[model samples]
Target chain A: MIEVNDLTKYYGQKRAISNVSFKVKKGEILGMLGPNAAGKTTAMRILTCYMPPTAGSATVGGYDIFDQSMQVRRITGYLPENPPLYTELTVKDYLMFVAKIKGVEKDKTKAEIDTVIEKASIGEVRNRVIGKLSKGFKQRVGLAQCLLNNPQVVILDEPTVGLDPKQIIEIRELIKNLKGDHTVILSSHILPEVEQTCERVVIISEGEVVAEDTPENLTARMKGGERVLLELEGDEKQVKEVFRTFPDVTAVKVNKTAGGLLKVEVESKKDLRKDYAQALIVKKIGLLEMQSDKVTLEDIFLHLTTKEEAA
Target chain B: MRKTLAIFEKEFKSFFYSPLAYVIIAIFTLITGYLFYNLLSWFVEQSFMMTMQAQQYRQAPPKFNVNLHLIRGYFGTLAFISLFILPTITMRLFAEEKKQGTLELLYTTPITELQVVTGKYLAGLALYIVLLIPTMFFMALLFIYGDPEFLPVLSGYIGLILLGSTFIALGLFISTLTENQIIAAIGGFALSLLLWIIGWGATFTGGTLKPVLEYLSILVHFEDFAQGVIDSTHVAYYLIFTIFGLYLSLKSIESVKWRT
Candidate 1:
């Protein structure tokens, strides 16, 4: 539904984003993961037709962002880093205004607003002035505004920033619920939130796409394979020798303690826990515990982003 | 067009949603009312003395034009009051949107920059017209107590509306330049005052420059309207000025996308 190719933007002489490119398929939830100043907001701004890019181009629903901006704007709904709201207006009034501007027909505006209000779970605060509402409620109102007119694509930048944990989870669940029906491009620095809600992610840093893949594929590619952490009560030298001699074992490190207890960390091309266990049993080496060490998305993000900086 | 009306409705309602609009209107009416009352008393006192002198000397009393004495004075005071009130009305038009981050919503919508500027400008014009409505009641007082020329009164109102709209368009343009409402208000007032007094420079200068200075002065065009004269030249001047101000506002709003 959206394609960004070699999109570059400059604010005066300073470059905000350079040659950044990514795509979102129809009905796919794509997360844009980047640290602060990674040009996440800049990219979203270009996509939403808020500003023109210095070079390259983007299209939403097959409408070029620059040449066909009106079409692009009509089909795409954006939630900026700060929710664009009028404090003086009531939630219902604000949404009604948004619906009108978004070109929702007059006959359908009220019904559409009620739909978004219910979808964003802001029904209780619909009649209250937005200024007096809590931040969470305000954020929900912002979200509800984006859902008006049944936009085909929704672009949200930092949707969960500055929210409490429970609110964050609720927002995450809400985003997860948008998976099949809407094409969503959500940008954030939070790794787990993206991991939990996004089907695919484009990890960006310093205004460039450093890595792009599914969450599981990213972590798997980061370590090359699984890692095993094992504790053994045996001769430390024998334990190390047994793991080193195993065929699929790539590397092993053993630490020997006072009571002949050995702590072993093994990295392998495949799962070797069972094979190692059999080897230890055949060798009469007493095994205390065995488990697989998981590589998280955080590690992969840091590795990729820092590697980009180093290069 | 529908989208522009939506924005217009929201902006117009926003003015009354706060105490700012009412407070400004109240202060404006009080000042104009006081000035009108004082003008009326002075006109009555002068006419009474004229009659006394005519009877004593066995001569005819001088004719007093109520439109000149009362209506002109009322409109002049209204123009001055508008210098203060119109800026306050327009200060929040774009500045508050920038301050509160609602400009993002405006920019991302399918509406063009021209529509946004026009919608906001019309809202400011509407508020200024509402502020002028009370002056009609003041005009009705003149009709009740004394006979006033209908054409002059009508011309005077047309002048006030035109002048007020010109100020509003200029104020709306100024509001787009900053996010601080105080700065917008003060800057708008300073610019309006400068334009209001620009014709003063024509008196001090000589040669070809005098006409140019006088032509640039807002008051020069408005003076004709105040005297119940609807010269096409003056009408054109205000129409051109209003369009110019709105044009600049549209350009300023479009520039925000690039500069920000």
Candidate 2:
């Protein structure tokens, strides 16, 4: 439900984001992956109508961000990187104030506040002053304010940054559940978190989109076919000699495990597990375990960002 | 309008929740009250001396009513003093929020920048009026101890309130122009004091330039209301000043999002 075209933002002489463009479909969970100063927050701010782009335009729910900002704001909810909260106000009061400003009806504001409090699972600490709450609760209160108006699009920047492991899981599951009801665009440096929560991933670096695809597709793209992990009991020199003789084993990395078991990461041009196993058996090098090491999202993120920097 | 009112209510209530508003009001009232008492005592002593001199010389003395003149002088002095105090009250309204990042959430809502500026201005005005409450008892003392002209005293207070509101608007505008609260407060104080000093320059110019300078001087217009005249021109001037200041605040906030 959001379309961004040639979006560029400059701070004085420095270009924060240059010629960035992307689209997020309705009901899709799109993750923006980037390092610090990668223009992720800038792009999200432009989409939420909190800031205007220096160049080009964006449309949310069919309304231009600059021209019809009020309409765009009506349908979009934003949680900034720092979780823009008023420390002096209580969580309940803060959410109530957000609901009022978000233009929820006066009669429905209380009910909406309760709904969001429950959704963010912050009902117990609702009356506590926000400044005194723990970081996880503070983050939840920020998320709760964003959900107050029931906007069509919810944009969260580093939503799980300061949370504990348990809170992180809960927040991820909550975001995953918001997929169909609200188009979610979240930015994060944590690659696996995005891989688990988002249906599509867009990796940005140096103010440009480096890669975009589903997590599976991006990992596959990075892998370029097949890879494998193997453990063999043999002398280091003998393991290297046997690996060199094996056909289609493109790359081999050997590690010595406990009790001198040799663990090796073997790259290949195709699936050759059966052939490799036979080669090890005939050579009398005991094959203990063998499995494919699938390329992960972290590997894809690191590879793409590092490659972009190198280029 | 409903959303704007909601913002106004919350902002107004927040002043009570924090110690900043209470401290500012208490300090303002204490200083103003002390100044009021000292000024009244001086006026009364001057009047008695003039009356005694008239009896000694066997001539009609000047009709020196201490309470009436003190009320007029009270408002005139308030106009000058509010220059420094109102800025302290309003300097943090927008600047502190921008500094701490809460402005982002407010901007992302469906409300217009005008509504946000107006809401903040209203909140500042409400606190200012509350701060003026203690000064009213000084007037009660005026009524009991001397012959105080009721309408003139009321008009002078109206002038003080209007003048204070105008400064709050100017301070709010300056606050929106920066993220540093101290810088905002300093900028606001400088601008309002400059406006207050504009009256002194009117005396330096001669001929036709004098009237033009006088018309621009806030003190020139405010003096009429402070003396209980209730001049329509002065009333219009304060109202227009408030609107102009609020307009600039709105533009400042809008430019922030536009330039982002």
Q: Could you say which candidate leads in lDDT? A: 1
What interface RMSD, in Å and to 1 decimal, does model 2 have?
Answer: 1.4
* Each prediction's DockQ against the real complex: 0.67, 0.67
Tell me each candidate's i-RMS in Å. Answer: 1.2, 1.4
TM-score for chain A in each prediction: 0.90, 0.95
Residue A22 lDDT in model 1?
81
Residue-wise C-alpha lDDT for candidate 1, range A125-156, written one tens digit per residue: 99999999999899999999988888899999
Residues B1-260 of candidate 2: C-alpha lDDT, one tens digit per residue: 88778778888877777898888888888888889988988998998898899999999987976545688888876666677788988888999899889999988989888888888899899888888888888888888888878887788888888888888888999999999989999999988887787778878889988887777677887877766788888888889989999999988888887673
Instruction: In angstroms, give how far residue A9 of model 1 lies from its true place.
Output: 1.1
Candidate 2 residues lying further than 4 Å off, grouped into runs, are A230-233, A254-263, A274-278, A286-291, B47-63, B207-209
Worst 10 residues of 1 chain B by lDDT: B69-78
How well does candidate 2 score on lDDT at residue B239? 91
**Candidate 1 lDDT over residue span B33-144, tens digit each:** 8888888899899989999999999998888889987788778888888888889998999999999999999899888888888888899999888988888998999899
Candidate 1, superposed: residue stretches over 4 Å from native: A229-266, A272-291
